[model samples]
Target: MCWDDGMVDPAPTDTGRAPADEPAARPAVRIAVAQRVPPRYGDPPALRRLATAATDANGADLLLVPELYPAGFRLDTDELAELAESRESFAAHLGAVARTHRIAIVAGYPERGPDDTVYSSAIFVDADGTELAHYRKLHLFGDETAAFGRGHQVPPVCRWRGWGVGLALCYDIEFPELARLLADRGADLICVPAGNMVGYSEVPEVLVPARACENQVFVAYANYCNSDDEFDYDGHSVVASPYGSLLAEAGQDEPQVLMVDLDPGLQAAARAHNTHRNDRRHDVYRGPDPTIG
Candidate 1:
């Protein structure tokens, strides 16, 4: 595991959370995050690289890649619209990769919606090549605001190999509300495909783990490294555990694939100790105060 200097290793110790004899409720799931540079638009070499990554991640239950990977992240609105792929075409390609490698995949792309609008989207496909969910990014970041239309629907939690997985793109994961909503709807894990550039290292350093710890779920953030014409991607891709622990991390300057195993016992223990879900003061949060109309 690649350790970040900021995060401490969560070695086992006596935390009075769960009893020693309790059985772990969920099976362990392994995930892989590909941290690399995305090829430019219309580059076939990029797809070959992705296939190689999938081939390399043979044993992991799921493989995640960066946001806007197919079309790259630096395109303008006109370029994005021109490059936007139909959902059917995206599925056919990614599904083939998923089946060939026998690994589930969550990847981001630009989609041409049926309404003639283009949106930033991500799709989840099981190992058998079945498309489970297609999520349009609810939050658009920076240049993305002008490049694509924002989504109206919330992401769906998908059931994959006994794990409840939810999908989010780069900017979406930064919203605590989104993560909390997913947790409320029974997501055990959230996979984020991000184009998190140089200035936003803090997102992986702080928010990612905080979201995981607070919600008692695993979060895997896959991002690109290296520079493009307009942006420099800071590859601090990470998998944060439910205990706010950094399970695995990739450095800021290199291309890497970080793999980690998710143990359900850890999540069970964290929830036992924190109990945030039970402790939330919803009535106070919802509000009907005499002072405020």
Candidate 2:
């Protein structure tokens, strides 16, 4: 991972809290995941304004933007670095937006490391712009592997408003083991920021829900809209319930913010009903290990 291991900062203290004797309100949480590719070259202020507008429009408790929001996925390492902004600056912008809108935000961007290596990373920013967590892409895609080093450690389960959230980028969702690991670590929800081309829409449409069903947790798959004619994405952003039911989905070839409500109690009930991974035979499942498939 490109993140600094020694940098362990606490979450922002500006988050609003309910009164101690308020009976712990069970307010419904609305989350919005944007399925739109950010403009390749635009003022960061404008982008932040757009994000704030969307959050306000949907009354979102949390907002998610697609991968590489600052820059379209550039293959060249130097190009990606040129597009990368300092974490402080990026967080400041998103934090302002989050604080203004009173919502948490998760955004993906290319990160330039101290050694000058670039890594695909996502940042979870609290309302005050305090960074809750940073997750680097463990599995690189296509030419990305050639450009960036693979992330080694799995990220910690993020805590937000009594919910445990997990993070993953594109291509990572294809690996069931990762999701299972997140679940094992007490994650109740997984947020995926992806860049899906035309032919790969089924991966999110079919595989995402299956992952949630098998893991018994909610999954939100957010993808980019499109670029020029050379790059077209089937924007099938989806939010699946713990039981694998499609709660909400964005249509193909459109820019949209899909909003869905997550119920942790319902997820827990689903897990109790069907303990798939929880009741497993690992002893027999661990066959002879081979590096090359």
Candidate 3:
């Protein structure tokens, strides 16, 4: 189900199963991606409210919010230090909301580590207010490379209701190898929180779907809607199936939460039907120079 500026509809339910006597029944998971910019620096309450409203409006099992959600993606060191917060405190605030709404949340923020380096991060909080996973972005943006230290480790797979979920930040999705790595590691879904400009519409529209089709996994892309009145974002937040079909997409300029039901069985079938695996020749076929490099 999706609620965009007061419009709502009944979401499709998952009824397909792999077999009758399967040990685990494939559960339909509804996810909502909020495509909106966070409040300017030092407005944590407003940021919390936006996230809470998105969670309430969609009633989704998991809510994905964009990176630097608490403080507008600040590049200056002075600004970052002024706005950064402890991971524990930020998780507490989101945890309270998750507990109140009985839903899980994936919120992004700038984390000030003990070493005094700021890292772009996302925290997964369950309905019971428990912090499940913390994914620090591995690939940093252009200027971010100079401002923030890159994370060295890939985050663990997020498990909810027996589904293996992967986390990727903005530029991370641009790398096909990253998604392929996640798929190889058993990730059924990849959630990306991005802040893309007007020119990058093709990323979500073309590249994201291509990534889904090639990897045979679902992708949820949440992008910032508007920022600073000077920049207009392409708010094409989308959910793509493993078949590379767009399941849901939001408008170009709006604060919307799009909900989509995901079924792993469908993804598996799509991969099998397309012969994406059977057709590949890893040993002999060499990809283009850029792909190899």
Query: Per-candidate TM vs. native?
Result: 0.89, 0.84, 0.83
Decide which is better by TM-score, 1 or 2.
1
Ten residues in a row with the worst lDDT in model 2? Answer: 14-23
lDDT of 3 by residue, 1-293 (tens): 11111222223223211112121355878998887754665555644664566555565888888877777666778888877788898898888878878888777788888888998887877778898777778888678887777876655455567666777888888899878766654567888888777888999999999889987789999888766533567788899999999999998877888888888678758867776645566546665555554
Sum up the clashes in candidate 3: 0
Q: Which stretches in model 2 have alpha-carbon errors above 4 Å?
A: 1-27, 41-57, 286-293
- Assess each prediction's global lDDT (C-alpha) against the native: 0.81, 0.72, 0.74
Which residue ranges in model 3 land beyond 4 Å of their true spot? Answer: 1-24, 42-47, 278-293
Rank ordering of all candidates by lDDT, starting from the highest: 1, 3, 2
lDDT of 2 by residue, 141-237 (tens): 7877887767776755676776667888888888998887666655677888887778887777788998899988788888877664337777888
**Clash count list over all predictions:** 0, 0, 0
RMSD of each: 8.0, 6.7, 8.6
Query: Residue by residue across 19-135, what tens digits does model 1's lDDT show?
Result: 122327567988999997767656774457668889878789999999877877865777777878898989888898888889999999889988868888898888888988888
Better of 1 and 3 by TM-score: 1
| Model 3 Cα shift for residue 228 (angstroms) | 1.4
Q: How far is 97's C-alpha from truth in model 3 (Å)?
A: 1.4
